[model samples]
Target chain A: MPNFFDLNVHAYPETDVPVEDMYRIAKRYGYTGIAITNHDDTEKGKEILPPSISTFVFRGVEIRTKSVSELKRKIKLHYGEVPLLAVHGGSEVINEAALKDSRVDILAHPCGEKGEGELSHVLVRYAAKNGVAIDFNLNAIIHSRRSDRARILWKMRENLKLVRKYKAPAIISSNARFIYDLRAPREMIALASLFGMKKDEAIHALSAIPEGVLEHKWKKKTEVEII
Target chain B: MKNAKCKVQKSKYQFVFYILHFALLLPPSLRERKRYLVFEVISEREIDKRELLEEIRDSIYSLYGDVGASESRIWLIDYDKKKDVGILRCAHNKVEEVRAALACIHSVNEARIGMRVIKIAGTIKGATRLIEKSV
Candidate 1:
């Protein structure tokens, strides 16, 4: 069976829910692993790794930048500081920049409220070549309803079509601020189908893509050479 | 009057027999195939059976529209309030649709909740067994 991984769970202090509780709940939900992602500005003091409860827990950072220069600066500063680096992407310039940066693992929420979409054919092509993954955040789907929900789904479908066309890496995540927001893996896969994703593709996004990113981090940290 | 009453009774008996014979001859393809989903509802407040059914229906109807909701054929088989575990029934082909709708649901009457699907079974008995083992 393919293992499931959630790549964008927010840690404590970012939300009142403790990070340990998030791991426990995620484990109970059958997630193979979870990455505790904290936003750059709020991440302060010594970041402590929560005790491992037999689930693979990785520390990550979400960087929000106003301009391309700021994005580059943050990636430069935070590279090697954390295993995973995600950029809060909504601005067109920022999205493009993040996609081209090999150091950036994920570009989160590229399509925000009032925004048409963040990825274009050109940007998606770059993302495919650069190995940057476009995030399909489920938070919008959970929070919106009626017309608002329809609009968000439309934007997501549009992005997904481009992602599939270009063969760019797509990562599906709850973008969950707390444990309650986390969804079961099978549930997420079914929801992904509404946006035209095949079951196998959704499974790849939830499992293989995130696993590959984590493996890259591990390799870098350990300086391992595989034969 | 006796003859007329005898004719009516004879016709009623034939009708009942014919209906039963036809049903027995019906092919499996003509029968409705059902799938049972065993799920646990995680929430802060206790939810009643009626409320749970209404909330799930409303979520599916809103997300997928009347046509999709009807096609899904959603029904509650069993619910345990204390355990917050339940088994739901739907068309076999529409299982994914039901799962998708359940995932979209985040709250019920201001109570935040999450649903986890533990098993999908072909029979109600199998689903009940799975629920017993899980719960």
Candidate 2:
């Protein structure tokens, strides 16, 4: 019942809260593990993580495309494997290109002119082929002003359909900026289901998908298993 | 919330909404449907987007019966150093024919061709009126 996963979390100079507090609050939500994913800055990720606490702390980054070459170069340059490396916002151009290479693990919040992180049937099919995980972002769901809810829901509903179609590679996250926003897996799953996600599908996203990505990033295929 | 979707009452409500939309449509034989408008301009500079959209919407309604906006899917595309508007389903017969029947034929030298289509929803008059005079 406590099974949970969070793919998008950050630590920056803008926020004064300490990193240990983030982990402590996640523990309150009963998270089995929490992946510390932030935007483009890897050193920041290296900075905040204190001695590994109770819940799993994953190191990752949300790579914003400086340019195509920069994207390829960064992927090749960062030898250290990150548990989650998401491309921020929803754009098909970035996802399609990033997913082609195994170096990229997650396509975080892909949005088109239509809005939302949506991959076409072609993309859904290709992501499965390349093993790039699709993100179902919860930050916008929880934080957006009510006026934008319908559009966000519309975009999320379309994405959920794709997640259902491509089950193995789906990932879900709070995309949290601050410690207070950290949500338990159940809470995230509940919101997901509210926006047309099936119950089992939401659960699978928080548990298996994030865990699987971590394993792949670590290249530790044989490590502990989840039922 | 997982079981919420499965509730019988929710499905019944969903069924009713679908039925209502279907009833509103005119069906193939009796329906006026819409015409697709493609405008080619002769402007050299990129026209202001809002200005261009307003011109296109007004043109469609002027020619095609109060053709407000049926369903507009506008894409501001730049190609061949030329910008064009493609209005898929406009109301009037005036904005008729395919390939080359564009009205308000302005300067061909610097203007880019544009087009817009209207897809009527609910009440055609009230629904299609998203097209404003200025843009």
Candidate 3:
């Protein structure tokens, strides 16, 4: 089995559920590791990290902002502080801004949590160049029904097309606030299939891509090599 | 006359039993291929078997619609309420489809729940063995 990682989970102090509880459940679900990316607005100045769990639970922040400048500042503030830096993406400007920046790791739910936002091919190409992974939040599909779910699936299909064309890295995350929202990797692949993602592609999104994102494997090298 | 009447009734009953048995049996090659999924549920509160079954059926119907549901041939083999584990049978090829449907069932009677398939086996005995091993 490949080393599977879920890079977009939300735990305390963002929600009532504790980080340990989330870790235990995720471990049982066959995940190698999970990142607790609580929104920066909620976790401000509060140390949510528990010393007991280190390697299993990676500390991360999801920057949720409305303005491009503020988003930039927040990314600068949290860039080196955390192992993973995700941007809560919605609206055209935020998605474009997040994808354009190489420091930003994953763009969580670019189409908004409710499928209201959109992404273009140009933005996706930027993501590929910047090494930003476009996140497909499966929780939206889990929670919505009928028309709402249909719209989310359609938007995801569109995003998948763009990601494919641009060859941008893609990651699938539960975005789980509760333990119940977490799904096994196999089930995640099945849900992703609804949006026309192939089994191998979904597996890569769930495992290899998230791992690579965590290690900054795709980030472009800026410094010149000393010969 | 009573003895003759009894004999005739006995022969008629035997004929009906044979026909029923034959109707129930299918050639191995013609039998519908099935897979048994052993799953466990974690819920906010205890869920009744009937309620869980209803929720599963509803999820499948909603996700795949009537035609897909019929083609899936889903059946609940057994459920242990205390353990929160159960065995479900579905068409062999439709395991992934049914798995997606199971994942879609978020709640039953407003009691939030999460389900995961532990293992899949080709026969009920194999599924039961998996449950035993897990427990």
Candidate 4:
């Protein structure tokens, strides 16, 4: 088997590196796939991929909307026509927006410590009801602003308990913005366990959770089956 | 009304109670303030809510001199979990003293803690709308 899957990540957005680099570095580290998910442009993500690519590359995008209709519209505007897109973390406004929209695949770290985002049980339930997958950004929790680390830990713990309570599907990602930030599955699992994830659960969060979000593209059911 | 005061034997909870009762005794006119004694207990046995209140009245009358006044009140709560901790507060102190006196009795086990306190002030209109009640 290949290394554990990291569900969300990006190459250095600043340098505009060629598409082949994502395939090379990701495949180099035993990654089974790479989604050249950059910013909000689906066409731009497609443009970033090499025409000669052999590894799996999915089109992805992030959003900046603060309301549900806006997010659905944005998803419709970008991904409803395409195949896949990922939303960034923010406050209740963004969470509400993402969960209410049918097209959004994953709700990225809505509890990002830096954003001081409040993830309430209502939002968790709403996300669960709408089939929204919550994100656990291990990379950000490990390497974000130091002042809000405790707050992030508290929020993550609370949010995950509610997720488990509601049996909500969750996706774990590195939220890696740089090539260096990309992690092998073991590395990703270690980072996730830092915030109270069991080893198997962390694996499910990374591999199964992202796969859950992209199941339609893989022609599998949206349910991320855990062994 | 017997205002019998005694040093509770060595216990962390009693120390907490001592702090509470002393703070309660600090009104501008100790002569006019009615004494309300409440003992909160978390026992090894399953104590219902009403039993818990009766226990509070019993402990207060036995330990402290009880001068029963309508406004004088003692509320004893049986903590609903495994943790053996309870809080007692007297309401007779001056404005600032009463404010600080019962500050420690925030919640009982898993009971609705902060919101109930808010409701006492004729607030907590309803459960948080945008924010759901923590289950």
Q: Which candidate achieves the best lDDT against the true structure?
A: 3
lDDT of 1 by residue, A109-224 (tens): 78864345567899988887767778888878887888878887888899999998998888999988766689989999988988788999999999998898777642343233
TM-score of each: 0.86, 0.56, 0.92, 0.55
Question: For model 4 chain A, where is the 10-residue window of minimal lDDT?
Answer: A218-227
Give me the chain B TM-score of candidate 3: 0.83
Model 1 chain A: worst 10 consecutive residues (lDDT sum): A218-227
Q: Which lDDT tens digits does candidate 4 get at residues A172-191?
A: 77665555455556555545
lDDT of 2 at B52: 60
lDDT for A177 (candidate 3): 93
lDDT of 4 by residue, B2-84 (tens): 33333333466778888999787756665454322222222235445554445335423432235532234544422333332
Ten-residue segment with the worst summed lDDT in candidate 3 chain A? A218-227
User: Model 1 misses residue A140 by how many Å?
Assistant: 1.2
lDDT of each: 0.85, 0.57, 0.92, 0.55
Candidate with best DockQ = 3
- Please give the ranking of all candidate structures by TM-score, highest first, separated by commas: 3, 1, 2, 4
Q: Candidate 2 chain B — worst ten consecutive residues by lDDT sum? A: B96-105
Clashing pairs in 4: A68-A97, B2-B65, B4-B65
| lDDT value, residue A165 of candidate 2 | 77
> lDDT per residue, candidate 1, B1-135, as tens digits?
999999999999999999999888868878889999998888879998888888899999998899988988999988999999999999999999899899887888888888878889999999989988886
